[model samples]
Target: MKLKITVLFIAFISSLTIAQTKVGTIDSEYIIGMMPETKKVVEITKSYGAMLDSTFSIRVTDFKVRLEDYKLKEKDMGELEKKTIQKELAGLEQDIKKYQKNGNTLMGLKRDELMRPLYTMLSEAIAFVAKENGYTQILTITGNEFAYIDSKFDITELVLKKLGITIPKG
Candidate 1:
């Protein structure tokens, strides 16, 4: 009997606590998109990507030239010389493949490096908005997650306003 009474008391208190929880959703990407700083990050990232591509292109060209020269001259060479050129070409091929892979990774690292400060600014704005508005929890979400969400509970504008981002006029 006492266990049943204790369970009911706990349930009542839990309900009260649940009722006080305030959930807020923000599209942080949208806020970041509106920031003037984003343009500079995009430009710098593109330039860095272009630089990587140019270097890769040059490496590939040299590899192709070396392979073509080896193929053309192999008929006249002794077995030992042929083997040495083939091995050198194989090593160059491997280097090219490795450089292509590393180029992609380097691009990602550069983008992340450029965006880190903007993300930090956005995070601070989100924190300030959460505290000021008494939001118990703040979520950065894609709109597709919820079938329906009340606009009043979306704190994107609040965070943007705090960040001093001027919305572009359509």
Candidate 2:
């Protein structure tokens, strides 16, 4: 009976050890923002945005100029000519709207394309840090899903360090 009780106690303790879970939290966005590569992404995105803006601006300006010209000449033009001009103006307006929508979609695709590799690198770093620190689970604290997290469990800095990134002292 004594040997059986000792064996039961040992099993219970071993079970408790096996059930222990080490959880860590990381803010991947914070780590990505701190990365040096993010600056280049930001710059490239800005340049691309500027180019899109300029192209849209030129189209809008041309539309406005043509609209003003039509308005000025409408009084002197015949009925059929006026209708034709109006149709042209409507077509230009629709084209501008379509171009704006397409440009926004293209910009979104470009942003994702530019950031995919960075996100992959960040993911790998987070995994490495979690494994090295013996974390059974690593949760991302992003958006509004995570309401509260203990500071002790935060591994953002650890992940950055693992990626060879130096945090600025402030």
- List per-prediction Cα lDDT, in the order shown: 0.91, 0.91
Candidate 2, residue 130: how far the Cα is off, in Å: 1.0
RMSD of 1: 3.6
Off by over 4 Å in 2: 1-20, 145-147
Runs in model 1 lying further than 4 Å from the true structure: 1-19
Model 2 quality (TM-score): 0.88
TM-score of each: 0.85, 0.88
Q: How badly does each model clash, as a count of residue pairs?
A: 0, 0
Query: Over the stretch 1-170, how does candidate 1's per-residue lDDT look in tens digits?
Result: 99999999999999989987999999988888899999999999999999999999999999999989988998999999999988998999999999999999998999999999999999999999998988989877855588777889999988888999877788
**Model 2: per-residue Cα lDDT at residue 92:** 93
Tens digit of per-residue lDDT, candidate 2, span 30-70: 88898999999989999999999999999999999999999
Give the Cα error of residue 82 in candidate 1, in Å.
1.4
